[model samples]
Target chain A: MNFEFTEEQLMIQQAARDYAQRELIKDVLERDAKAEFPADHIRNIAGLGFMGMMVDPKYDGSGMDTISYVLAMEELSKIDASVSVIVSVNNSLVCYGLEKFGTEEQKQKYLRPLASGKKIGAFLLSEPEAGSDATSQRTLAEDKGDYYLVNGTKNWITNANSASTYILIAQTHPDKKHKGINALIVDKDTPGISLGPHEDKMGMRSSDTHSVMFTDVKIPKANRIGDDGFGFKFAMQALEAGRIGIASQALGLASGALERSIAYSKERKAFGTIIANHQSVAFKLAEMAVKVENARNLCLKAAWLKDNHLSFGIASAMAKQYAADIAMEVTTEAVQIHGGYGYVKEYHVERLMREAKLTQIYEGTSEIQKIVISRDLLK
Target chain B: MKILVLIGNVPDTTTKVKFNADKTAFDANGVQWIINPWDELALTRALELKETADSCIESIVVANVGRVETESTLRKALAVGADEAIRVDADPKDAFYVASQLAQVAIGFDLIFAGIEASDYNGAAVGGMLAELLAIQSVSAVSGIQLENGSLKINREIDGGSQTLAMNLPLLAIVQKGIAKEPRIPAMRGIMMARSKKLTVATPIEVEPLTSILSFELPAPKASCKLVAEDQAKELIRLLHEEAKVL
Candidate 1:
């Protein structure tokens, strides 16, 4: 196994770093405080072709490998993970899904814009009662020949108001349970579609998290991603790949906090010497560094497996669960290293701590990851 | 007007500089390389010129004097905007040899832009040597450039202020920051298209070396800092006057 990153991968990392350092980081503190969407930043990154890094070039994507996408994700998340989540959903869930399963006409009409950053896309799966138990989808879709009328409320939608296209998972045959679920591509401008006010989130507040309600929304049958009952498999596969994205994001958040602590420790003095000279403080930094490195290896391994068309389900689960846990632990210690400043918002570690919690809970919760792992082992 | 931008390979800014055991040379293990920042900015401006109008500025070419590693940087330049790249196979003996190699490759181009100095060595010599060898007027610390009528106006930063000079085609320039507002990051499509873009490897015109590296050393580290508590104004003043020797 080669440990070195390819030249193209390194270049992608540099481009992402340059853009994040120059543009996304300028007003980031203020934007996080005000919970402002980075529309301009998104547009600029789109110009760099980050929005659809892994999609095929024929479909307006950059046709990059998953490893490159993960590298970009890690870089973007280092400074502003809220912005990275919006990017992650677009690339891992929306773009990858449509490219892998959607028909040619579907790809031509919908995937191109999402791939080109002309429009944002959302993947709708979660609901009030179905967070971890996605199989219990309550959203209903009534078939009407050429179109299907869908009525459902999806909670925790990442780009609810901002997205132009949505992959809505709804039940077509309630009698068949999960086998009845169908995935439809619904436009945001469709009739009877309404978005609730943005949820006041503790962290990642800049992302447009909301409850999207569709009342008798008519969707073209042609917009279905695959065969009638392919929604469950499609979602499972997409989330398996998407877990790598979240794992990389978590790794970024932890590493960013650790880097801040390292810089601060050398600069902040306590007893006639810098705090880093103290063994207690120095050991903590070492531990944080080790954890971040470990998490990066696991995350990259998962992404590398997927890029090679290998079975990555178990590897991805482990990576996400491990990285998410490490993110929380590392950020907490990072704030502690800041002393009382960690409790306050200005130090930024507090924000990272808050943001890191969601990584453990979203995509697939730590508990669900265990289930995925155990199931793979049993099989 | 064909513009040939000279590219240089330098250590990434974040790489820790280290000297060898005998202090004769820098340790080369696991060193990361990147395109010299100033040359990258120059290439970006050349592309910008071509982008604005296709008339005088017809094509942008980048030339580098190194082996495969340096060609990797040129590929990135291609991804950024350079239409053609010429990689000369050589060890980059000195500024004169590098300049001569570039001078040979830049024979047909009307304008040439290169970084004022390479970050690794800070020699600030290649651009001037190219001008001297090619028999063309040259300027350094160029911050900005604009195309007007049939001539290109160049802006240079001097000791106290800035000045602009209009120069005809076929002139060499040593450029700094204002050449472009910012260097363009290669787009994904650009990186994709770069895989197919023409990267020509040229036979180096051998030149006798005029200089050679001798030794390497790192600067001294800063002294340890002393913390001054909020309540110790008198103590701080005493130490500042007695120990620091400034009152």
Candidate 2:
């Protein structure tokens, strides 16, 4: 099989890189410093058709391949990881889930707007008690004839305040454990639904993150994502897609850090020679390059498998784990290469390092990804 | 009404170039390609025209003269709003060959559009040659185009400003950047539709080349900027006259 990217993929990658450099990089540091959500940046990205890179055309999506989507994410993250996460959650976690599991009417109504970028989407599966064990969620959706009364709290959710629709998971029958979990779509403005105070984050602060509380929220039964007990399955599928996005994010952050390190090392002189001319500094750059390249390759392979409808669950997990670890390693090394300058905010490596940490924590923790890969391997 | 857009897959402008050791050709390694940015402007105008008419323009057909490697560019044109694509499967070393190949496939179209020049070659000759071969009225460096009652109204850039011209149907125009902002990235759904859209490849008629590349090289490095003291305006002017020789 040919591994080279098609011309279209290359174009998307180049366009994303160009857009990121020209549009996103200028204010990334200032926005990160102030913990401001880049609302206008998101609008620009939406205008570029990235908010729905994989959704079908009928809904006004870009309908690009999975790899193209990942490439776009990677390029965007390279300039600013915070913005990348916003796009990732919207396209992979929320829209992909709705398109795959929702009914025809659901696709027409919810998926169309979300895919078209006319509305933002958020996925709410993590609760205070159910961060990793999603089936043990405390949120409940009690049946009330034509509607379900949803009452619960989801914490640390991305895009909670700005999202127009939320794909929320709650227990419809708590006695049945995992069998009772169900996915439901809730409009952000539905009565009894309100956003919690925005979180003060260390990195990716340009993307708003907040808690969501649903108290006696009434949603029509038609809003159910899939069969009654398929919420966990839907969440898992979404997470699988989300892993690719996270991998791309890791790749982007790492590549950006590496690029900065290389440039700095070449420009800075030490002991009458460029730091890059020293074996110690040169070796670090080389290692970072190796990790970034390997991580990118893994991400591309996983995304390709997913796009082709092949078995990619295990591959996705592996890619996510490798990329996350690589991002952390490369960014840390990038900071080290900067020496004292890296500690300062003006240098930017410190910010990249902070951004790299989140990739290992969200989507799936590095530890969680390892477990997933091991389980798949055993199977 | 159907409109045909001729696109060229040219090397991305930001890419670094290298020439062969013997200087007869340029190295192709690590070269990235993109749809000529100017053609994207033309395509956008066509889409805008189609959108405003309230009647779906029958189709926007992109015709290219290249190999299968060019399919991606064709797909992009489709994604950006073209309905189908046709490839004249030949390299076409010169503009006449490309023009003749396009003339063969451009029949039954109300207008033919192209970029002023491919970013790779910067020849800027294909549009004129195609117009000559097809015996149609031609306009080059079009910054704007409008369709009305089977005629094309075009605004083209001249030396310092722009000139507007109108031509009947079955005309040719080569677009320039001042036409419009680069076309927006195709939407997700448009990309999906492009996957199944019709793209036909046909053998191209052979035409002889008139000129070939002899060599390529980087331009000379710029001289270092010299700093002149604020009080030495006279010296700066002397330097400009004596050293830089601009005065």
Which candidate number would show the highest DockQ if scored against the true structure?
Answer: 1
Poorest 10 consecutive residues of model 2 chain A by lDDT? Answer: A6-15
DockQ of each: 0.77, 0.30
Which residue runs of candidate 1 sit more than 4 Å off their true CA positions? B224-247
Cα error, candidate 1, residue B237 (Å): 12
Candidate maximizing lDDT: 1
lDDT of 1 by residue, A202-271 (tens): 9998988999998989998999989998898889888998898899999989998999899999989899
Q: TM-scores across all candidates?
A: 0.95, 0.83
**In order, what lDDT does every prediction score?**
0.89, 0.87
lDDT of 2 at B121: 78
